[model samples]
Target: MTDLDAETEFLGEWGRFQQQTFFLLCLTVIPNAFTALSIVFVADTPPHRCLVPAHVNLSAAWRNSSIPLEEDSHGGGPRPSRCSRYRLGDIRNFSDGGLLPGVDVNLSTVATEGCVDGWEYDRTTYDSTISSEWNLVCDEGWKKPMSSSVVFCGYLLGALVSGQVADRFGRKIVLVVSIGAHSVFATILAFSSSWTMFCVIYFIVALAHTSRTGSAFVLGTEILSTRVRKIFSTVGGNMFFCVGYMLLPLAAFFIRGWRMLLLALALPSFLLLTLWWCVTESPRWLLSQGRAEEAEAIVRDAAKKNQIEPPAVIFGPSHNECKPERRKAHNICDLLRTRNIRWISLTLWVIWNTLTVAYYALSLNTSNVHGNKYLNCFLSAAVEIPAYILSWIMFRWCSRRRSLFSTLFMGGLFLLLTLLVPANLVHVAVALEMMGKFAVTTAFSIMYAYTVEVYPTVLRNTALGACSMASRIGSIVAPYAIYLRSYSISLPYILIGSLTVLSGLLSLLLPESNGMPLPDTITHMQDFPGCCKKTPYKLTQTEENEPAAEGKCPVVS
Candidate 1:
């Protein structure tokens, strides 16, 4: 195969064609923002208490005393019990003589019972959520977290399947199919009559969304030149995701009902179908498959769009050219077949898991923050803008390993700081949480670019998929991590902070790939050096011209 970056050098890094393609790919990520975190609003649990029966003849003051106060879980003082009520029968009997409780009759002896008649929700914040409509609180409270976990489960399945399909079929087809499926299922999810039906459809939506996102990331990176690829991966991809996340809270604020909010989010995805006509397959991918004619045609069109004249032979004869009979088919198993690649893959999986857990744990915890839920969510999403910008700057000048390690360490440190914040200073706690989010968002953005560079093109998507699949283990644990806040306000922070710090230490073991050409084959990865030592392999004259040949070092010096 031709060195794809060198072969396409005539088109320039930021030509008209490259600019247009980058914009369209980034657009696909916006709707996915809504799909990934909309559960924050969809399953929100409003303040609620046991319902008082209308048949009980009692004054307003007497009715108010029917529900007993319980100790607040967060040390905020006594509040109304969510799942229990003082026995109404005892209250009614005590009030038969029109005697008030506490003064005339002792109410301490009264026993409490579960909310048998159902509960009444406080709809000040949300007009209606799945929690209020279906009563997913108390005994059925487990279902809310289960619903969030189901989405991550779908993500795990999508990562496992989409990588293989994209590698086999093509990136364009996978992107098209995944986006269309996500739109259809998300729209269908809005009209669900039962929670069971809703969860099943939501799972499919999550699966399709994950596939669409992975395919878009791989396609964007492959099509752009090495210099532009870093920009596209770090800033271009995640900035749009942040925009969609910010928009979600704004949309949910106006459309407080869950069904309508879902409809508003899903309907706009159909506009993305136009991408099929504008987006082309990755030239790098086509050449790797030995479809030189197709790759050349796309290259010529890009040259024409950029108003540059192409040479007589765009791709010269080279040793890297693909021979179908001689080429061994690559699969997920290939990731673990070698020593260097195996260790790299294992290290990446651990890093990905830690980032996923910390990132989602902070994002989902916005609802439980002390201020207005909408404001908290909007601020959380807004903080990612600067984080991504900082990531792009670091990618341009700093080492990938050092950038990742610094961000993870700082993020963990910020989260740990939350434990020392006084309970009375709610704003201080919120600020620390956002700072943690900012740092993790930066690390998460860097991880995307760094992982793509670590593997060869043949197994890039497959490796990314496998690593993504592993990260779902953390995402699966994230909702429950947030749930831990109910037990002790500090438990979630302790868990997330400790894991994040540990992952940063693990990242030091991987090799640095700054300014290195993307590896095209397993042989290329084998020749590459690790962060700590040099392989000291000899290269042919032709190999000397390759980009990866320039960056084999024993240490930073």
Candidate 2:
């Protein structure tokens, strides 16, 4: 065990203070879940057709027949064209002569034109969406995906900045400020008059949202003991996010308007700001900053809540004397300075990027599925419950590498199975998609704990932030990947599945960290057990003979 863990062992694991912090910190993720994937419902493009002007007088039958039939890109055979309509002048002349369209003139021979006036949307599913409000269809369809990409662009910036800020300041300050900022920006986004304005405000909201999420995860992990960290990281953290995910469809189902739904999602973030008083600053972070007195005060308070007597000297002489060394500033470059850490960082970047692409692609593709969009989205979020539970079980007993590899492989296999399911069995295809969601969700939950264990406390938040920034590249690509469904229905699934399996194969090279103590410094990092041999540090004969120097190497094996 690390010296810090040994010093704080008197409070026991799962005390009142730890339990309260875990619950409150996990609550912060709910708003993040709402804002992260709200684009699916906000920008949904419903069925639409060209508008027939009232000036061209015609019977209801003739007006209904104005649009020509075209082959459905989703494989439902010929359907009414969404972007074009029969030349209204010709149709009007035919109606005046009392001749019908298929009876006298062939629609195949009739010339078609783009919607000259405007478009009319089918409001059966959504009463109003950004696509319907701003007419983001036909030639304007590219704007819809661009809006989602803008949010992720903000995520990229936030990840790069938040990590360094939190590591330099403290976790609690960042969490409070981010939560408040997100709530304010999200409220202003509801009043957007144009698509350009909405995108700008939405970008700021996403930046704050990402900051809030990363800070909460880091704070919760630092505050809790090692034994309890696994539970809080996997089940406690992600399950709340699942709750918000499930709640989104229910809120959208009732509101049916994009603006009001955004307001609903935004208003709840104010409630999370109350956490500033209830949550305590992380003691580990304080000690790392060379504030031993502040760290001791928090630890003693935790002990008081647990009803245990506090030790007279909580930090001891070793921690007090070594304060100068622990206070040194570390940056992102520090993650690449060492050999084992460099290998781990590069591998994690690939794994994070691949998982993000697959996860968001499956999530956003819910609208393209055969069932009701609301029900499909709800099922997708609901399946995460069992996935998280299974993740907790694996973290309790299984090796981190094996658990990540198996879950990712299973997720890819289920996605690939969708190709074999026949078009006639729509239910089977939906089931396979849900199974893929379940497996990927499990792997995602396990990844947070595994990443935390691999890095030292000093660079933990920075490493996570950098990895998150890299993952935004995948998120930016995910919407376009879903756009591939326009060409072939199975195309998105095939791409996401292939990448997921490849990532699972790469994860085998990461060192196992299931039961190891949290590394306090870069020198204490764990080595790759089977893939790479550890290089021992050179020492003098007298120093090597000492018990403290006997097994101490620059890098642990």
Candidate 3:
């Protein structure tokens, strides 16, 4: 019998054992959610202007009016210049002349100079953030978003090594180690004395955090039956991630300091350490590693907890055969060795990178979306709930490829619509952005499942690892995408929208996997309808080693 058949007999779908394990694993995603986007608050830049030095003898009105007004480079609104002030000497002279502040002082004619005295931040919303503490304003504005990019760079570095290490050292060990390391570093990140120190520590925190979350997700997924896999991934994992996202705004509302906020985000991981006692290793992983005895023991334990009797022979005899030849692992070269698989691999990478970039671009842009930052963040996260539900429903009722592409295109379309919205109608623009966010959220959920379905099992994990690394690269670039607002406010939306639509078009070139059995080999993968040459794929053992032919894609069945 196959692994799925054995899993059905031994564990049953959604049994008590599965539910318990899923819940424990899902709990871990909460803290991950907090850390992933905590930068939104931690590095937030509230309304600010150059500080009016106390030493300058100026009236309160003169002090307030001293900062010259300038046209916003991004949105063209009139606002006080963040990095400049009316020349201090001019203000000092005006005050010395006994002219009351705001009393016919042609402030526009006054010369302006770079702020010599740093800045004063509006504290009504946020008491303090990294942007305020480090004066990362004006000339230093890029550092705010770059801080996030630094974390994602760490994610890229970790993705490079974590999967191979997890596959070799076991998922549970890596998951636990990453969690501990993430927590420790995250705590240190809160106490950062300099922006450089924060970036360095945050990088390590991101690496450990991504590694832990990825391993936990995979471990939880591998142990579940196919019947509930989609639900667990979409509703359980993605929805729970949204829950953490939603909670961030609420937490920030009360805890206004950036250091305290980072502390809050970091502290939750310590609580996650408790799960090490409750969560079990993946039985599938054990079997793959040829530890059949441990695999059976886990299955039996699951059966007992599920209140079901195990069969006398819990595992098939094939599980006990230690074939050293079967231990050979496929590498990146294997994914590109075939024509159909290579095309599918490249297309999948595009979709992954596009979706991830667009998703993070929108997520990071919430602060600039013309609403209460906390409200915008909450609404942005809240939208993901319905998005995940729609994803779950779509996976159940629609073609995976169609739903995936449609959602991506629709998201792009909504973001594109934002450009036509009049600048005065900021509320309308924000609404459209939220709609785009909802669609992108749905597409993200669909893409995760669809990617797994596209590749053969032998190269599945490797393919996913590659795609995840691509995603991290996208994330690393996402901040700069959002930063484009410095040039034009519409640029970020236009860029993300255009790329998302292009990704939808690219997705259409790939085969649909709905209702199809997963391919087990490169030959089987190439044989899938719409992924092959006009001629049927039949590879002889010797021919199988050859590079796939280029430049042809069969029509979808």
Candidate 4:
């Protein structure tokens, strides 16, 4: 749709406060979790744990440092102490002589404490200086990548299950409950005494954590006029990630412990609930559930708030969109019933997942920057703000095909640069990857808005939840990709770029929703394929209730 249509239909009709309030809430909600993805960064170590030249001795040190043991065990027995239990396999005892001729220090014992949660120890952590989480996960015989993959799996599972939970339980209730669940689980994650515990809690917090995502998207989409719907819903959704990426470095820079980091990240879920009191339910949702009276009440209040008078025209008992339907229980399959919706949702899922893969994979590799990692990480993330701005501008100025294609193209092009450049120019490589990140970030932001336009109102949340789940596929695979330096760098780039290109092409297959009334589900979308360019949308027999005026919902703004 043209800007004239956007302004005429959306800008003026939507009372400023209503639009602005939702926008503010969206921006506010994104920062906490988006920033937390970087939590794992503080726990990441460079391959081989690069030893810095700090002018320190290579000699080992006494791990447990019991003053009594020091006094009793040949005090200062002309032997160097073990410096760290980081290499538990290297634990040993020596008498100022070569460790007993045939002794296997590697076999002596597994240190019990101060280790990453993945591995179990037979004894206590012997050192205090280094990140035990890093060392412990690192020494897991090249399984670190696999361990990180668990987070991605958690992301997938969270997206799949939470859609029904949100629909069945109500968004407000889910949000309220998830706040507690997220904080408690995240806090418990800090006390993880074993790798098994860490893995389980990671999934738990991840599932609860996702509650904040799709529901917010649904709310943002529901509260907007059709013209501005794409921008409000999609850009708002993408902004969540942008806000998160920005905060990651702050956490990584200031917070170190995995537990403390999780707690900090989990706190926002609680805070968002308190602020939720200022908001209201999506009357459209209530109306769909056959609760017209309740829906009408909400609409009347919304009109009052916006200073618009509610109309008396009654919608019939047979209305579909924004009218009550005896809503059947929902599941993932419901999202695929319509051709346009199924394809579009699948595409969104694939695109976002691919972008996330490239993002987490390359972004986490920043430890190689070595000095001031916090600075490089933060600067890289800061670059994404422009990505959002660019997406906003392009989405307005260009077709979805052109806009999506260009964004994905740039991301791929830059990722290619990162691949082709010689390793000597490490800074250049990093710059290219940062640029790729920005491009994907821009695309990611745009896609969220794009998905809202594709599905109709009824299946909006379900389709979105499905797509969101798909996007997390990349996240699942990312850790293992960039983690292995021995693997060819070109491989990850090629994979991400190809997936993005495919997604861009997929956008061409979708009907343009520009200037069209927003759809509520697959059925609605199927009802009007061209969206308002060629034909007027006709109400289905059972679907038409009363000849109510358009924009006549009891709620205003």
Candidate 5:
């Protein structure tokens, strides 16, 4: 692949073609942000109470205050109970006597019953959300997060299925198909007549969403040279994702209704269909599939864009050298067959799970915090701009392991500090939580680049799929983790923070891949510096004396 990359004149380390491709692909990520985080608004549980029935014949004063005051499960002090309503028949006499509600009557003696007439929700924040529309409070409150979990389960399914499909077909085809599938399902989701239907359609949306995301990322990455890959991966790609995220609050602010918000999110997805005309398939992927002619044409076009002439023999022996060995076709089992790779794979799994859980938990819990849900979500998304910028900058100067470790450790430290901050200083606690979000976001950005560099090309996609599946598991569990807030406010933060710290320590075990060449085979992986013991390896005279290039693999002594 290094030789292949070097052979292409237009796939410059940093050139005009790369710039155009970077921005074009970055555009594809905006809708992704919408699809991923819309649940924050759609399932929002606004201030609500039981609906007082007209048949009760109570006065307006009693009707408004019919719901009893009770201690909140999350320690918000005394608030109107959401589920129970007083036996209106018993309380009607007091209300009809023209007495004040709670002050004049011993409301404490009134027996309570579950809400039989449904509920009334505060329309100040949202005109209608799924929670309000479906009465998903009290006994059904759990369903809110369940919808999000179902989507992640869809992500897990996509992770398992998309990689093989992409490999068997092509990155561009899977990407295009996934974009269409995502849009179609998402649009249909807006017309859902029941909670069950929304969840079902949402599952398909999640499946397609992950597929499109994986394909888009790989297609963009495969076409770039190592010198500029990180720039596109973090700044150009993930930064746009952040922008889409920031746009969500603004959209939610205006639309103010769940169905309208869904429509707003779906409308932009149609624009992505235009990408089929503009975006080209990865030349690298084409070459891997034995379609050398197609790959060469894409390269020539890129060279033309960059104002360079292709060599008559664009791909020489370097392109064909590894073809025979590569024909073996590796799978996930290869990651565990060798002892050293097994250790690396296991550690990477832990890091991936930790980052995903920490990231999703923080994002989902933002709505539950004591503030404007939209503002909190926007701030959370906005902070990522700097976090990503810092990650990109750090990757340039710091070793991969060092940057990853420090960010993960700092994220955990901030989350842990929230426990010590008093509840009265909620602003201080939120500030600390945002700081934690920032650190974890930085680490999340770094992990993608790190994972690619660590795995060999043969098993790279498969390993990434496996890692992605592990990440989906984290996302699936994140809602439950955040649900812990119902029992204790700090529990989710504590759990996420502790896991992040442990993952940071585990990351120390991975080899530094900052300037190493991309490994083409398992043998090449074993020879690179790693967690295993540094046993001196035998090398031929020619290999031992080979000089190293800046971004090429150095011969092992």
Candidate 6:
């Protein structure tokens, strides 16, 4: 009846089908691409608009990629053979456009400046109305941003609780719960009657969504074979982001209004929840929870289904394994010891939070993009796909520390570009923004993998959870930095840029972790930094470290 028992019972997914389903279901977690700081922008397509100015040209703005209805727009008399329309309705015409779903618009220009000044086209609502009724503003509208911030706080709180929940309840049950809650909460937000209601629903949505992300990642990482596990885990985050990006435009195309958009996105979580009923649970978690008997049953079932005999190996870590640290019993004292290990861990956390704050805050508050927010946002996402692929390839060739620092370097350089290039040069700014995103995305991917590598096994989850919490804190600070006061306050970006550059310097101070096995015990932890090859690590029991610790590590590196 204990969660540990339930956990052990579920890990033995011997059947190939069970394994495949478990692995495949990870795709369900990938829709977080539209996760800008939660102020749902007006979709390109509005609700029903009765305004017909004698012509209905169908071109998307430069920021949008939808094909133009040039004939009607550019005085070609609505002929199909006419050149494509380059613009859409002005802000004055931003009323509801009838819900007719067809093509997706991928470009918008205006103040976004992806296009030149004269071509600063107005955004047209492209798709159909999402729902019968939508609330443009929740009551007590002042709380919208705070309501969204609740999502970040939810993530922090969820990370704090997730380790225990997943351990006690079992990841499968936990995932199902999170999935169900996220769907329900998000769906309710669509029908929110007041600001209080929206805030409450969004808070629930945040909690569920946050826990789901944690569980899904843990599941995805564990399901893979050891040889491929680390790389695949990193890739999972990267791949899902691309999928999420595509979903954004699709949401734009189908859900014309905010409520419809929210509801449509919410449905997918429910679909994922339903899909979970048939998928097998993680055998690893089950084993950890001590439900050996149930774990065996699942494996036996898997063996029968796959038509392959089960291996004698039990669901336990290999002897060569440096068992992961378990620092999750809630000791703030342990975290604040401010010694080498804890401090390093906290520094990494700060780095992560700073990066997320600047990255998402900027993306969310791109107010200058007047014409087509959809296209501007979409293009930004498209640029991120390569950033991930490149990270995988390069991280393999270079040490994690160097690869991470280089990415930071690139991001800082781009941030500097944003500062120096001046605002009037919109195209240059857009290019710089792409460069900045590319760099940051790469950094984001690598840091997650590297942070895990740096920590001892027993403390891994606690360490990571702490880092995630810092990231949330940063997330909170980032939005207000961009959205409040002088909204154009470039200070956030500048500060972010400087911190990132410092992070690169800090990265240089850390020991490189190429080809090194993870150190699992603190008894083994303090010795690791100076022992790396290239900066080879070796220690004598009598002394804290040897002369090699003080010298340039011989790269056994």
TM-score of every model versus the real structure: 0.95, 0.94, 0.91, 0.75, 0.92, 0.70
Deviation from native of the Cα of residue 502 in model 2, angstroms: 0.9
**Rank order (by lDDT, best first):** 1, 2, 5, 3, 4, 6
Error at 25, model 3, angstroms: 1.4
Q: Write the per-residue lDDT of candidate 6 for residues 1-557, one digit (tens) a residue.
A: 01222222333433465456545555655655544422445312132221223244532332232233323321326332112323334321321342222323223441121111112122355332211122222132234456557667777787677644664566677777887887777778888775567667777777777677666665554444443445554665667767777667667655666677777776776667665656667654444433445655666666666776655653432211312232123333455554667656666776788677767765665533433666777776777788878877766667877787899888877877687775467688778777887888888888877766665433545566667767888777765665452434466567777877877767766667666554433433442233345532344453333212432211100
Clashing residue pairs in candidate 5 (N, C-alpha, C atoms within 3 angstroms): none
Q: Rate the local accuracy (lDDT) of all candidates.
A: 0.86, 0.85, 0.79, 0.58, 0.81, 0.56
- lDDT winner between candidates 2 and 3: 2
Question: TM-score rank, highest first?
Answer: 1, 2, 5, 3, 4, 6
- Mind giving the per-residue lDDT tens digits that candidate 1 earns over 1-557? 34567767889989899998899999998997787699999999999999998877877767988888889988869999999998988888777768787788766778999999999999898999999999999999999988899899999999999998898788999999998999899999999898899889988998998899999999999998878888899999899999999999999999999999999999999888888999999877776676667878898999999899998888654323445344457888998898778888888999999999999889988899988999999999999999999999998889888899999999999999999988898899899989999999999999999888878888989999999999999999999999998799899999999999999888877788776767776666633235634342344566555423432211000
TM-score of model 5 (CA atoms): 0.92
- The segments of candidate 3 whose C-alpha lies over 4 angstroms from its true place after superposition are 74-77, 99-109, 456-458, 518-557
TM-score of 6: 0.70
Off by over 4 Å in 2: 322-326, 529-557
Please provide the root mean square deviation of candidate 6 (C-alpha atoms, Å).
Answer: 12.6
Of 5 and 6, the candidate ahead on lDDT is 5
By TM-score, is 3 or 6 better? 3
- How accurate locally is residue 319 in candidate 4, as Cα lDDT from 0 to 100? 34
Off by over 4 Å in 1: 317-322, 526-529, 532-557
Error of model 6, residue 411, in angstroms: 0.7
Backbone clash tally (model 1): 2
Q: Identify the leading candidate in terms of lDDT.
A: 1
Residue 429 in model 1: lDDT: 88
- Which lDDT value does model 2 have at 448? 81
Q: What are the root-mean-square deviations of the candidates from the true structure over C-alphas?
A: 4.2, 3.5, 5.3, 8.8, 4.4, 12.6
